[model samples]
Target: MQREDALRSIDVAVLAGGLGTRIRGVLGDTPKVLAPVAGRAFLAHLLDYLARHGAQRAVLCLGHLADRVTAWLAQGDSHHAIDVVCQVEPRPLGTAGALRFVRGELRTAHVLVVNGDTFLDADLRAFVASHRLSGAEASVLCVEVEDATRFGRVEIGADGRVLRFAEKSPGPGTINAGVYLFSAAFLDRVAASDAASLERDVLERLPPGMLHAVVTRARFVDIGTPESLAAAAEVIGEGTP
Candidate 1:
């Protein structure tokens, strides 16, 4: 399928429900996505990236400071005008739970998912096409970094099949890019939990071939900590990814 066609057909689901516990003390009352970066909300950058890739709609799963994110979207964005749907979580739901909450609203059999706090400038079309061609139910966008200490490593075979998830380490390794293309059936396997990690509970258990990986060299910046948030502008710069 054409890249433009793929974007229109697939819906985006962003996980922005976390409390931002690590940075909340510094950025009081602000949701992680609302964190200022390069003079604008970080989410604006993410939305722009999606818009550039031809994504037309999104489902934002929000909880902590949910109103803030929604209000930002409600004010109306003139730049990247994609249709937005906000799914407010009654309580904190883990990554997997939040995605599950929007099950019916996703509308598509598969949806592109990303972490609101992380900016992974990957090629959306290639990521989607990779999953389509691999015949896998799920695929994680992976990127190689000089140090995998920040995020645990994801071992992927030469065929792009996920082998195992390794613990954090100081040395260089491949890690999840915090982006994914997941099938509805694969997400349905998650039977509701107080808080479940999409990685630990689901993806990690899938058979080698059932889950795949798409590697990219796009810049990756996550604003999980105050330090990272401060450094984001330098990494992302003033241009769109």
Candidate 2:
């Protein structure tokens, strides 16, 4: 059942609404997701990747210079395959809040959530399949990294159910990869009026095992910093897998 439903039934929602304050000196007014990499907008790479995985549509949650993102999507950067939609937030709603803002457009009960600033080259089908098979409300992709200081650490049980999320600290552990598969029922748990953050207000606050994870040794990059943005070519350049 999951094999057939996984392809067309799932849509993607990318949360592209951050202030990019940390890299303001370098990016100026451009949103972090729009920062040029390999002579093309970073969102282009993300859209292409999603389309390649057979996702026919995507709804991008926009804020913090929403017009710029909407304009790019209008340019039809996503050729021939997937259709892209933009939902600009009235104000800066946090991560999960952005998703909540577009709750009406989720074409699938299980929608894929991706961070606009981070790209993880994981098998998208398998990730969604796990969520479908396990019958979990929410599932996140975690990447094993040498240092977890830059990101929050995720602890999961022997059965791959999430245990607890540790605050960002220096250590060797699995870090949240910023990609998730969420069921609509779980998204409904998010209050419409509340300013919600994916980590702080949702993931951390959820009961143990309510959220599950699939830890992978995948190639991941979060281009939120100047140093990492400079190195995007190596990871997202032409001929990349």
Candidate 3:
């Protein structure tokens, strides 16, 4: 399929249910995804990004303070015209569990799973194309960083297959950008219950070469902490990706 058609055919699931423990001091009662960035709620920016890429449907997997997020969407603050659906998790499910919980709401063959607090200004079209070409069960967005201490490393082979997930260490290496593209069949294999982690339980245990890694030199940001949150506006507000 063409890039636009591919993007339109895929659904976006933003995992926004995490408790912002690290940034609680900075944004006391605010949900992490609602933290202000560039004069707009961070979730708004994420929806805008999806709209720009021709995504027509987005299923928000919310957990903590899901009502607030639903209320925000009800206010029609998002500039994009994309159809948005809110799926509130009954309890705190890890990233993998969240997807399994909302699998019925996903209406596409491929789903672009994105972390609510992280942003990667990479080429979505190319990423999708690579995933399609690789024929892997899932694809991960990887970026090279000077320091991989904050984020753990994602070891990938020369052929672009994810080899292993390494522990966080202070050194220059490639890291998972917290963005992923998974085929519906892949998600169907996950257990329907239990709070399983996306990193430890799912991706880490995937067979070697089963997962594709789409590495990019894109500008990336994870606003999980106060320091990164403070720098998000500057990086995300810069030029278009």
Tens-digit lDDT string for candidate 3 (146-228): 88899989989999998899898998899999889998888788645453788788889888888999999988889999999
Task: Estimate, for each residue in 82-193, the C-alpha lDDT of model 2 and write its tens digit.
Answer: 7788888998888978988898988787888899999877777677777778878899999998778899899899988998998889878899999988887877777454
The CA lDDT at 236 in model 1 is: 68
Q: Please list the Cα RMSD from the true structure of every candidate, rounded to 1 decimal place.
A: 1.8, 2.1, 1.4
Off by over 4 Å in 2: 1-7, 191-195, 238-241
Candidates, ranked, TM-score: 3, 1, 2
Worst 10 residues of 3 by lDDT: 187-196
After the best TM-score superposition of candidate 1, give how far the Cα of residue 72 lies from its true spot, in angstroms.
Answer: 1.3
**Cα lDDT of model 1 by residue, 161-199, tens digit:** 988898888988888988998887766666344437887
Number of the top candidate by TM-score? 3
Q: Poorest 10 consecutive residues of model 2 by lDDT?
A: 1-10
Give lDDT: candidate 3, residue 217.
Answer: 90
Candidate 1 TM-score over all chains jointly: 0.94
Better of 1 and 2 by lDDT: 1
User: What's the TM-score of each model vs. the native?
Assistant: 0.94, 0.93, 0.96
Please report how far candidate 1 places residue 38 from its true position, in Å. Answer: 0.6
